[model samples]
Target: MENTESRNTAFEDIGQRISKAAKASRRSVSDIELVAISKTRTADEIRPLLDRGHRVFGENRVQEAAGKWPELRQDYADVELHLVGQLQSNKAADAVELFDAIHSIDRLSLVKALAKAMDKLDRRIPCFVQVNIGEESQKGGCAIEDTASLISQAQAAGIKVAGLMCVPPSNVSPAPYFALLAKLAKGNGLKGLSMGMSGDFESAIMLGATHIRVGTALFGERSSAG
Candidate 1:
């Protein structure tokens, strides 16, 4: 089928890119994970990618993920679900139950809610802080000014402080921002950095990203699952 072919082509393209980047950077291809972001795509599209051996996925909206995860889990129980969106406090319980990683914790209130949710469910979860390295007011991230303090709060609440995640501002060089995050993560000795996306992933890899939230490049334009 055409969809299957597209998935194959996309996988090959991503593999080629990863190989080239890893070679260029002199880092092992196995070091970095290419999370095939399946935000708006359906099972028809995602199944092919999973069949191709992509076990990690990123979803941008909690609502969308809530609808798709059940079906996706039925087929791929081993799939790792990552919530890469601005998580609302009301959705903390659902997120803790559904996602393997929360890559957008940028507020103290959000962290408190997540901690409570995890405690209530008696499950320890992995999570990351979203830093606004680009300083874009439109984007949802902890302003760089308050990062260390935020981390302390999460730590006190018994939340697993995994790493940091960030979105580079559009229409500009994101390298400096990525570098800043890299330095910050190192300073904190964090274990993960879910930076970069379809457009700026190579740069992200170069700056020591452990995970990339690739959506469009992996699944084509957003599929209206509604």
Candidate 2:
């Protein structure tokens, strides 16, 4: 577990870094949102950051988030949860109910399922079309060539298409991939770029990333699979 003083300090340091990067890119610091990925972290480990008033968090699995956040949100009114992993069609309704934003709308089937779920529930959660910017076969995102079509389908179904999200190929310079995701968002008239992580967030901010998902830096390191 992390002490309160260190957790506060880490949060502030990341905030300062975000401000500097946003300024260097000629963008407003307020325009960028820092989503502290809390997947695999326990509520005891997460409460200190929440105590510091950081409300936005990212979780990879709906079941894990459901176990923790329903109670947390009851305690903190401002909490905003983001689904940052590939969502299954079967879990669309549950995801729609739990997450304030969904960042992995990558396929036509998912788009259709989420749309129906939102309609049935009467909630309109914002969505980000995850793009396979690196074109990796094992990864879970729409191929770059199919992004526009997915966006159109999402919009037509009344889903609030917030922007684009991507995880660039690992162990490589991610700047170009970040830049490409930014370009794709701009070309498609989207605003949010959910591209950076703990390692390359500064570069992502410079490349017009509106949202960054930082896990390890904020939470020290995850202990086990959730």
Candidate 3:
């Protein structure tokens, strides 16, 4: 676990980096949202960031978030949680109940499930249709060619399609992938681009990533025990 002082310093450093990237791109710093990826981190591990006034976070699993956030939100009521991993259709209701935003809407089944869940709960949850930007067989995102249709389908189902999200192929320059996502969002008449990570977020910001999901840079590498 990271000590409070180191965590605070890291948090501030990330904020400064984001500001610099946003300015370099001629974009507003306020427009880029930094979603601290908190999956696999315990509540105690996350509390220090909250103490530092950081609120937005991303979790990979609905069940993991359910285990912690309800209790944590009791104290930090304004905390915004985003689901940033592959979501199964069966968990749509639980996700609709918890996450402030969903960034992995990739398939029609998931979209329909989310739409049904939102209607049942009477809560409109914003979603980012994940695009398999690198065309990786192992990753979870809608195929690049299917992105437009997915966004349209999500909107027609009453799901608030916020934008698009993607994880570029690892060990390569991510700038092109980020640019492609931005272009795709613009083509679909969307604004949010949820791309970037701890390692490449600066490039992502320069290429117009509206939201960056950072984990190891904020929380440090996860222990083997996790």
- For all predicted structures, in order, the TM-scores are 0.95, 0.97, 0.98
Select the stronger candidate by lDDT from 2 and 3: 3
**Candidate 1: worst 10 consecutive residues by lDDT?**
217-226
Instruction: List the candidate 2 regions with Cα displacement exceeding 4 Å.
Output: 224-226
Report residue 7 deviation for candidate 2 (angstroms): 1.6
Candidate 3, residues 1-226, lDDT tens digits: the string is 4377788888999999999999898999999999999999999899999998999999999999999999999999999999999999999999999999999999999999999999999999899999999999999999999999999899999999999999999999998999999999999999999999999999999998889999999888889998
Please tell me which predicted candidate would have the highest lDDT against the true structure. Answer: 3
Q: Candidate 1, after superposition: displacement of residue 199 in Å?
A: 0.9
The weakest ten consecutive residues by lDDT in model 3 span 1-10
- The TM-score between candidate 2 and the true structure equals 0.97
Per-prediction CA RMSD (Å): 1.6, 1.3, 1.0
What stretches of model 3 exceed 4 Å from their correct place? none
Model 3 scores a C-alpha lDDT of 0.95
lDDT of 1 by residue, 129-170 (tens): 889888888999998988888888898999998899998888
